[model samples]
Target: MSAPHGINPNIPHSARVYDYWLGGKDNFEADRRVAEQTMAAVPGIRESARNNRAFLGRAVRHLSRLGVRQFLDLGTGIPSQGNTHEVAQAEAPESRVVYVDNDPIVMAHARALLTSTPEGRTAYLEADVREPRTILEHPDTLATLDFTQPIALVMVAILMHISDADDPEGLVKAYAQALPAGSYLVLSHLTLDLIDKRTADDYVAATSSQAMHRTPRTGERISRYFDGFDLLEPGLVAVSKWRETPLFPDEPAWMYAGVGRKR
Candidate 1:
C-alpha cells in the first residue's frame, strides 16, 4: 500500500551499476566503484552490457512486429536509450507496456520519464520479480493489460542477480503461467559458459556486497526456464547469437538469450 524505499546512494544497486557500465551518468559513486571492479574481473563487461541492451531492442522490435502488443518488462532498470516501450511502440504505436522494478530510483525515474505513445499506455510498478504474483495481479497492471491476450514477458540481464536459492525457474514459470497461450517469454541471462572459472568466480565475488549472485549455467540449465513453451529459432543460444545483428558473430557473449512461445 505504501511507496517502496527511496534510493540509497550509499548502497550499490545492480541496475545503477549496469547504468554506469552503459556510460549513463545516473549511478552513484558506490555503483561506479563496484561496476569498475566487476569490469576489471571480466574485461568485456561493458561491451557485454551494450550488446545485451541492443539484444533487448531487437527482441522488442521483433515481438512488436509479431502483433504482441502488451509487454511486462521486469527489472526495468534506469531508463536508457532504446528501452522496451521505445522499441515496441516504434513498431506498433499502440503497444502497451508495464515496467516493473524493485529499485525505488528506477521507479522515480520511470515515473518522470518512461512515457508512451498517446495511443498506447505505460505504467510503472514498484515491484520485485521474485514476487511475480504481486506484479501480475497489481491494480496498475490489471488496468493496463489483458492477460487473455498474448503478452511478452521480458526478463533481461536481471535473473543473474537472483541466486539459485531464489528459484529463478520457478519465478519464470509463475510469470509465464499468468500469460495466455501464444504469449512469449524473452530473457537474456549471465553465464560463465564462455569465460574461465576463475574469472567467473571473481566476477561473482565482486558483486557479493550488493546481494547479487551469478549463476553460470550451461545451455541445458538455461533451457529449463522455457520448459512449457516452444522456443524460437536458434534456441537458447548466447545473447550475441540470438537473432543478432550483422556485427555479432557465432561466438558466444558472456550472456545467453532466448525467446519462447507459450503453447
Candidate 2:
C-alpha cells in the first residue's frame, strides 16, 4: 500500500544511525545527532557497530568456505564495506545473495552497492524481518535461493529492535523451519549483558525513535533465540570473538554473535 511508506529524515532510523557510526555518507543529520548521543552514553557504541560489521564479514566468509552458496540477509542496513554478497562471493564466486530490508533509502542504495560476481547473483527485497512469510515466499527469494540446499540466514545487529510483544522467538522459528537441515543461522544482537544499566538506559533513550524501538536483552535471553539450532564452536560470545583472523584486541561491544546450524 503506497509502497509501505517513504523515508522519514526527521526521525533517526537505527540503520541510518548505525551507518553514521560506521563512518558512512548515507546517513542524515538526525541520524548523526542520535548516534553522537548514543556515543556519549556508551563510548564504545561506535566500536560495537564496527565490530558487528566485521563479525558479519567473518561469519559470512566462514559459512561460504563451509560451502554455503546462498544467503538471506535480513535487516540489511545501508550497504557498507564487507557486505554479505561481497564477503560470501569472495569465498565462492558463484554465491547467491538476497538482502531484505524495510527502509526505502536502504533499498535504493542496496540496489546500487549490492552487486555480485559474474558467476554469482545478488538481489534486494524491501521487506521487514518481522514478516518471515513475506521474505520466505517472495518470488525473488524463492527464485534466487534453493531451499533443498544449505543457505545462510544472516541477521546481523538487528534483532534487538524486536520487542517482547512481537514473539521474536516464534518468528525466528518460522524462518528456521523454512530452511534445510544444513542451513545456518548467523545472528548478532545488542545486549545489556555487559553494559551498566545507566549506559543501557541512556543509550536507548538517545537512539530510540519512531523508526526504531530498542530492546537490549541478556546473554541468557539471547541464547534462547538459538534454541532449535546447534551452535557452532565457542558458541555465542561477543561479536568481536566470532572467528575473526586475529586483530588488535578492542573493548567489548556488549553484543553477542553466533552461528548455528539447523540440525
Candidate 3:
C-alpha cells in the first residue's frame, strides 16, 4: 500500500510491523519484510502481538467497568480492531480517549478510524513518548482529558522502543507524577526471556535497522515501571495470562503485562 504523504514507505516502522502482525493492511513492503524477519527469529512473535492486543482489551474493559472515563494512550500503534477507544467506549460510551504516537502514518490512520461515540471524544497527538511534556501539555490532550479525574495511562507494547539511556522507568514516573490518586497505569513490554540469544539478537538487529529499538527487559525491570502504584489482582504476568485464560498455557510468555492504580 502507498504510504500517506510525508511518510517514507521505504523504512519499516515498529507500529506498521505490529499492524502487519495483527493481520492489518496498513503496512508497507519494508514493514512486512522486517516483520517476517522477526517472525523467523521467533515463530511465536505473531501470537505475542495477538496476546498483547487481547491484554489491552481486557485491561481497558476492566478499567471502564471501574468508571475510568479518560484514557491517555502512549505509543498507540497503527489503529486496529479492539483499540483503546473501542474497548473503553464499548463499556462506557462517555469515554474520552487521547491517542499518542510518533509515527505519522499511525496518527493518520487513527484520525481516520479511531472515532469515539457521540457521548465521548477521541483526539490524536503525533508525539513521541519520550516527550512526556509534549503529550501531557498538548492542547488536544488538555481539552480531552481532565487531570483531576482518573485517567488510564496505557503503554502497551511500546516501552521497548525506549533505550536505557532514556531512563524508561523515570519516564514512566514523570507521567505518573502528573496523575492524581486513583489513576491507573496499564503497561505491557517485550521480553527476551523465552527466546534464544541468537533469535533475540536477530530480531533486534532487523528491527533496529529501522530505528526500532526492541529492548527486552526482565520481569523485575518491567515491574519497576509500576512503582508507586498498587498492582491489581494477578500482578504482572504474561500478556496472555493477565486475567485471561491463555489459549496456549504451556508456551512461554514473550511480553509482561500489568495494571496498577495510583496510591
TM-score leader: 3
Query: Candidate 1: lDDT of 41?
Result: 68
Best by lDDT: 3
lDDT of 3 by residue, 1-263 (tens): 77678889887888889999999999999889988877876768888888888899999999999999999999999888899999998898999999999888888889999888999999999998999998899999999999999999999988888999999999999999999999999999998776678777766665565555678899889999999999998999888878866544425468889999999
- Go through the candidates in order and give the C-alpha RMSD of each one to the true structure: 3.2, 3.0, 1.8
Give per-residue lDDT, candidate 2, residue 96. Answer: 98
lDDT of each: 0.85, 0.84, 0.89
Assess candidate 3 and give its lDDT. 0.89
The true-versus-predicted C-alpha distance at residue 83 of model 3, in Å, is 0.8
Clashing pairs in 3: none
lDDT digits (tens) for residues 143-245 of candidate 1: 9999989999999988877878999999999998899999999998888787777777776776666544556667777889898999998888777777857
Summarize candidate 2's per-residue lDDT along 154-236 as a digit string, tens digits: 88877887889998888888899999898999998888777667877767766564355777888898888788789998799
Task: Name every residue pair that clashes in candidate 2.
Answer: none
Off by over 4 Å in 3: 195-211, 247-250
